[model samples]
Target: MARVLIVDDDKNIREFIRLVLEEEGYATVESTDGRDALRKIKEHPCDIAVVDVMMPYMDGISLTKEIRDIYNIPIIILTARGQIEDKELAYTAGTDDYLVKPFEAKELIFRIKALLRRYGTGEEEAPVRLGNVLLYQQNYSIKIGSKTVKLPLKEFELLYLLGKNPERVFTREQLIEDIWGLDFEGDNRTVDVHIKRLRERFRQLSVPARIHTVRGVGYSLEVDE
Candidate 1:
């Protein structure tokens, strides 16, 4: 059973979420503010976090940013503000999803399940061998011949998605939606920047896997044998 942490200022809301999650066979933890939530997360990480944007001690956006700095745990932000700008802010702060207030419990549960399904678990058949590159998904790291290179969270995610389906092309827009959560809205150049950084790191380590640009389409990871 997955364990979920619910962070909100309202006692009623917390109890409601706790009961629902418990019914779904998930263990629940509750925090009334972001500071407490952060401490709890550091002490013991949960499978998912549902955070309210309007907390008393520390706001959800700041908390989300802090969490992103250290952990890759999935987070969903809850807010009364239904504006696109608010959603975008949540995304920029590293929320995995966003839900406006007055949402149905069923909808929240569905979103939680969907995120877990998309990111949860699967074992690789074998060590992914692409030319001189060896990607060990089990341990979440990579090697190029003799030297091992560690990837940051976002880079690893992007590379893994591309490498998993080698030949398939994905546009920047698709990537942003798929990887960075649906609410992410920044310049498309952000994708280009990350790609350039990824390519540079691989090159520095002499890795053979290449990120191919499909003009007008997007990028694909191609293993050159």
Candidate 2:
């Protein structure tokens, strides 16, 4: 059974999610505030998280950013706001999916299952290997050749997506939409900077694969042969 964390200021919403998740055979933990949610996550590692976009003390976006900094757990952002800008912001903060307010419980459950599947959390495997890099995706750590490099949330996620698809191209827009959440307000340059940093880390350790730039398109990882 997957363990899930529910973070939302609204009592009813949290309870609703908890009940639905429990029905799906998932164990759940709840927090009504972002600060408390962060603490709870540390004390109890969860397979996934469902967070509200707005909250007192630390807002969902900030919490998502902070959590991504330390963990690779999948996250779904639940919000009343349905603007494109809001979705963009959530994406920039590293949310895997965005759910608008007044959403159906069944839809939420479906999204969670899809994300879990995409992340491969249902598998009972060891580290995932890409060329000379061994990615401990569940833990958000990477082993490049002889050196183990700890990645911040954003970088780890960026690399993970590219590594998962190998040579498939991902446009900046696609990346921002998929990984950052739906409400990200960042520019395309942000993607470039992160990629540059990722490349540098791989280069420093002489990793066998490179994150290749597909000019006029997006980026991808290519195993050098």
Candidate 3:
């Protein structure tokens, strides 16, 4: 049973969520607010966090960024406000999902389950081989010849996605949405930065696999045939 951390200033809301999650067989820890949620995670190490948007001392967006810096768990931001701006801010802060308040308990459970499944599947993704290099999806590592190398999560995902498709061109916006989540409000330069980093790494390795710029469009991965 995965443990879920519920963070909200509203006691009734926390209790309600706790009950719903427990009914679904998820063990839960409760926090009164964002600051408290941080402490709870350190003490109990939850698999995912369900965080309220507005709170005293620390808000969910700030907490989401802090959590992302420290942990790799999925986060769902809950807010009574349904403004598109709020949704954008939540995703920009690194939350994996969002739920506007007044949500059905069943929908929350479904979203939580879906996020869990997505995270779990990352470890089972098959390794991709490109020419003389191999990208190990299971562990975010790469093998070039006999040496194993590690990659930042985004870089590896971008590499894996392109490697799997070979010559398919992926536009910057497509890459951003796919890798950073559809709600990501950041500039397309985010994708360019990761692509630049990946190119630098491959160049250093002297690999035959290359990530090509599609000029006026996007990028693609290519290897010697």
lDDT of each: 0.82, 0.85, 0.87
* Model 3 lDDT-worst window of ten: 117-126
Model 1 per-residue lDDT tens digits across residues 55-138: 898999998998888877788999999998999999999999999888778767767866665566322336677676777655
lDDT of 2 at 202: 78
Clashes of 1: 0
lDDT of 1 at 73: 75
TM-score of each: 0.54, 0.55, 0.55
The C-alpha RMSD of each candidate to the native structure, in angstroms, is 8.5, 9.4, 8.7
Give candidate 3 misplaced runs (Cα > 4 Å).
121-225
Question: Residue 29's C-alpha lDDT in candidate 2?
Answer: 91
Superposed by TM-score, candidate 2 places the C-alpha of residue 142 at a distance from the truth, in angstroms, of 31
lDDT of 3: 0.87
Q: C-alpha displacement of 44 in model 2, angstroms?
A: 0.8
